[model samples]
Target: MLLNLAIKNFAIVSFVEIDWQQGMTTITGETGAGKSIAIDALSLCLGSRALANTVRPGCAKAELTATFDSSNISKATKWLAKHDLQQDDECIIRRIISIEGRSKAYINGSPVPLAQLKELGQLLINIHGQHDHQLLMKSQEQRRLLDEYADHQELLSSLKFYQSKWRKLNNELTLLQQNSQQRQAQLQLLQYQVKELDQFALQDNEFTQLETDYKRNSNAQQLLLLSQQCIEQLSESNNITEQSSALTQLQKSSEQLSQLAELDSAAAAIASLVNEARIQLEEASKDLNDYQQSIDIDPQKFALIEERYSFAIQLARKHKVAPEELVSFHSNIKKQLNAIANDDSRLDVINDELEQCFSQYLEIANSLHKSRTTAAQQLEQQITNSMRQLNMPDAVFKLAITEKQLNEPANHGIDEIEFLVSMNPGQPVEALAKVASGGELSRISLAIQVILAERIVTPTLIFDEVDVGISGPTAAKVGQQLHKLGHSTQVICVTHLPQVASKGHQQLFVAKLTDGKHTQTKVTELNQPGREREIARLLAGDEVTDSSLANARELLAS
Candidate 1:
């Protein structure tokens, strides 16, 4: 229930605070006295869009706040707890609109996004504006009303569950189908690449080793000629006798120095140096002779090595990779080929899953369609009965659910639901929007609200000027209906009719007060006598006669 409402700099309402109560609280005022200003402020607190000009003439911003007692509103309390915004049993919702067109919302002193405010607001209040009657013409709204009346939350949940699974499978199937051709083309390219890389028989370190062997073989003849010349010059050259060779000459010099060293110790050091030099020359000659014998002059083997090296370079260039990295590249292509090979099998599994999901969705949708059909019939009879009490004595209401033609499953089941009505007997039922008058529309809307009152989760219901195009016994009936609704929930109504205002357990009078240069709106709760006078004013217009006061009293007593 709403406990308090505060408004500041909102339109012509500079500052106003209203203390509200349970049951029907009717707000009455003369035309242009700002009766709707309070409701507008309430709307802003509930997350309605605000205009920059909503701020008063001299004010920089407009602010509105509503305090709700959440002790009785379990849904609201649960919502607050879910969002971590709960503050005791009291929930304060505030909205501020700046003149520069910026808006901010707060829940229990916590700043929140507008979307969150709107979501939480729905769980707290249900506002039926005068124009809400036109929603009867919308088929979507009609379907929603029937579903609410049915109260088959479990069935609705099941339907949603099936719908979700089906959509998931459907999306996967579409993706696979769209990419099937591309995947096949990629597989073919991968296979060709794997085959080409396989023919190379590439091995780690093999390319480097082969290149080394190729270079050595290609220069074998030059290496053999150079080593043979060195061996001949040092040991057994054809140009010099073996005894006259450098190695033989160094050996003779060392032997003669050794004899002199034996006679004189100073010569011993020179003799050792000569002997080490002779030993080094002999080892060098032996190394050169061994290298010359090891050289291979085979032309065919050298050509084979050269061809292999060129093939490796060509393949590496073809794949746009370095020579050493070709082995790693080959491994990658093989892995891709294996994965592509599994696509067909994976696609088969996905198709089976999709089929199962589709079957489940269809079964649940069919069941949901049956339940909605039964609920629609019961809803039509109830609303028809309500319309009679609202002054449409011979009214007839019908809910038409037609099957939708589709190649695949749809989201909201298979039926298109609409509400049809006939105002008088023997008349064919037509779309409510086309035939119902403005007054008839409001009354019909009220009747539906009354029927669904017990099922609605909102703790407060505000009827903003919904009494338009209604008066006489009809207005009285609307008032009584609102009063009945109030028995179950808090109802605040803005009205110009005394009949409706008289039924309120609490009455508030909205009036405009003006200084010479400024105007402001205020709301005052009327006492018994004050309510009587206001009702008298409503009954007798500008002048409140004695008879009008008597009539107001009688109306209130009734």
Candidate 2:
């Protein structure tokens, strides 16, 4: 429900604030007295398109703010949470239109895009203009109305779910059918490639181990000669026998120096360093001997390692990957081959799934169609009875529901719904768009809205002069319908009829104010006496006669 509306620098408004309440509220004024201007301000705050000229003269911008009580508006609260906007039970929508034709919109103090503002606005309020009756003439709108009345949201959701599955299956089938020949050729190529790769018997880390073996095999002769040289230098040789070896010489020198250390302490320190060097030399000689013994100097192994390493390099170049990555590459190729070889089986499975999806979609759509048919019949009957009460005694309203041959599955099901009306007896019923007069359309629109009031999700409904071209008992009937609708939700109606105005729980009067230099629009909430005088003016035109006041009082009392 809308809590308050604030307008500033907006088209003769200057500044005005309205605290709205739940139930029916009416705004009335003479023609061109800015009643519609106030409605326009409310519309702008609710994300309507704006113009630069909407800014009052000498003002930089036109600003509007509408506050809504969102304690029960779960859809809007969820939307705010989803968009990460400010979250509160009080939702505020503000719009600013500048003199340069630029517009900015905000929701709950968070700046929002105009599109988002419009989307959120839809959940908060619905405004029906005097021209909105023409919307009833469209087939799509009529279908929507019937669907809303039928309350078939769950069935509609199931239809969408099945339709999506059907589309996915069909897409897969189309791709396979359109490229069957190409896929067959690809299958043969993949099989041959897999066969070639299978011969290599590639293993994880095989390339790395092979490279290591190749390096060892290629340097075997050089390795052996170096090991032999180190052995001769560290141990015995022809020129350096047991005593002449470096290890032997260091140990003998250290023993002699230690004996002299008893006479000098500095000599003892030099002897300890010589002993450590001799120990290291002995360990190196043992390791060199072990390495020489471990060397494998086989010509056949060298040849085999060289051949395997070259094969790996050539294959790596061919596959456009490093030799180390060949294992993963081989696995990927095998997967492709497997998929191609199993294409016929996969295609059969998809065909079965597609058939199943279509069957399910048909089932759900047929059920939805039945519900809509039932709803259309009841809706047509109700509207016909309502139109009669609105002064169309001979009016006949019908909803035509026909099954159309769908080229492809549609989410909305198979029924094509249209509204047909006849204003007089013995006249052929024609489409509402072609046959219904403006007055008849307004009544029909009012009837539909009143019938669907409880079904609509919008918290506030604004009727901007929907009572146009209606008066007397018929106008009273419209007022009574609006009053009935207000009992369930908030409603604001702009009107000139006294019968309609008198039905409001609260009344506001818009009038032009002049200070000789400029004219501005002012809105005043009328007390009981003020309401009586205003309604008397509405009944008596330019003069408030005694008889009009009496009638206004009686109308208010009733």
Candidate 3:
């Protein structure tokens, strides 16, 4: 149940604090007295969209807070606990809207997303606006109402899951079927590319090695000539008797230095250096001779290395890749070919999965159909009885459920639901929009709300002038139904009818006051005498005559 509502700078209400009570509370005011301001404030706290215009003139922001007692509301309590927002039995929801059109929501002093606030709000209260009956004309709204009344959430969730899976698989199958010819053509191209690459058989890092081998083999003759010249200059000349080679000159110098060393110690060091140079020269000459012998000038081997290197460059150009990247490119082509080869098997798998999803969807949908069928019967009987009590003794309400076309599958299932009604005896039932007059529609809407209220577990229900098209004894009946509903849950009604106002266990009067410079709305709880005067004002306009006061007292007495 709603405990209190505090609103600041909201609409024309500068600041108002309303302490709500148990049972039915009627809010009465003149036409422009801002009776619905409280409702609008509560709606904002419940996650309704807020606009900058909702703030009072010249105000920076608007703030709204709603306090509820959630001890008996198990669903709300569980939700609070799950969200880590629980604070014992008290649940407070607050909303602040800035002039910049930004808003914030809080639950139990903890910031929350607007969606979470709305979700928790649904478990706390259900508001029925004056224009709610207008929504009943829509077929989708009719289906939703029926489903809500039947509590088919679990079945609907299962059906939705299967429907989503079925749609995914069906889309895959369609794509595969549409692209089969294109896929076949692509497969042939990829197969040819893979086979060509296989014949070339390029190995990793082989391109660099091929270049090295080709260069080395092409220069083998030049390398051999250079080695022979070095060997002849160091050790032997083309004329063997020519003692002008580097090794012969170094050996003669060493013998001369040895003889000088006996005369001076410095000459001894110079003799050792000359002997080391001769020894190094001889070893270098031997290495050059060995290298010249190892060089091969075979043209056949050089031709093979050149051909391999040239072919690798040509293949790289043909594949539009660097010479080193041909190996990876070839690997990718083989992978594409393999994927295309598996497409036929993938098509078969998708068909099987689509069939399975359809079977599951149909199973859950059928179960939901049965549940709705049963709920419709019960709802029809109850609303019919309620309508008779609301001064429509001959009204008949029915729910029509028919199958949709086989090809027209929908996420909500394959059923078309419509509300049917007949307003008079011998009048064939027709669609609600076609048969019900404005007044009759309002009464029917009220009847349905009253009946559904008995089944709903929400702690509070707010009706914002839902009795607009009703009057006289019918207005009294609407009041009685709301009052009766209050026995099980808290009911708040904003009304203009004196009969309805008289039925409330408590009454509040909304008055718009102006001080030349400012206009504001104020709500005041009415005591016995105050209630009588307010009801009189509602009955006889602003005059509040003695006769109207007597009538107000008589009505309250009943």
The TM-score values for the models, in the order shown, are 0.76, 0.84, 0.83
Ranking by lDDT: 3, 1, 2
Per-residue lDDT of candidate 3, residues 211-247 (tens digit) = 8888889899888888888887887778866668888
Better of 2 and 3 by TM-score: 2
Model 3 scores worst on lDDT over the 10 consecutive residues at: 403-412
TM match of model 1 to true structure: 0.76
> All candidates' lDDT scores?
0.88, 0.87, 0.89
Q: Across residues 312-391, which tens digit of lDDT does each residue of candidate 2 receive?
A: 88888998999999888999989987777677677879978877788888889899999998988888999998888778
- Highest TM-score among the candidates is held by which one? 2
What would the per-residue lDDT of candidate 1 be over residues 332-368, giving only the tens digit for each residue?
A: 9999888777766778898788777778877877787
Please state every model's RMSD to the true fold in angstroms: 7.9, 4.1, 5.4
Which segments of candidate 3 are over 4 A away from where they belong? Answer: 204-309, 348-352
Relative to the true structure, candidate 2 reaches a TM of 0.84
Model 2, C-alpha of 260: deviation from truth (Å): 7.2
Pairs of residues at least 3 apart in sequence or in different chains that clash in candidate 1:
none
lDDT for model 3 comes to 0.89
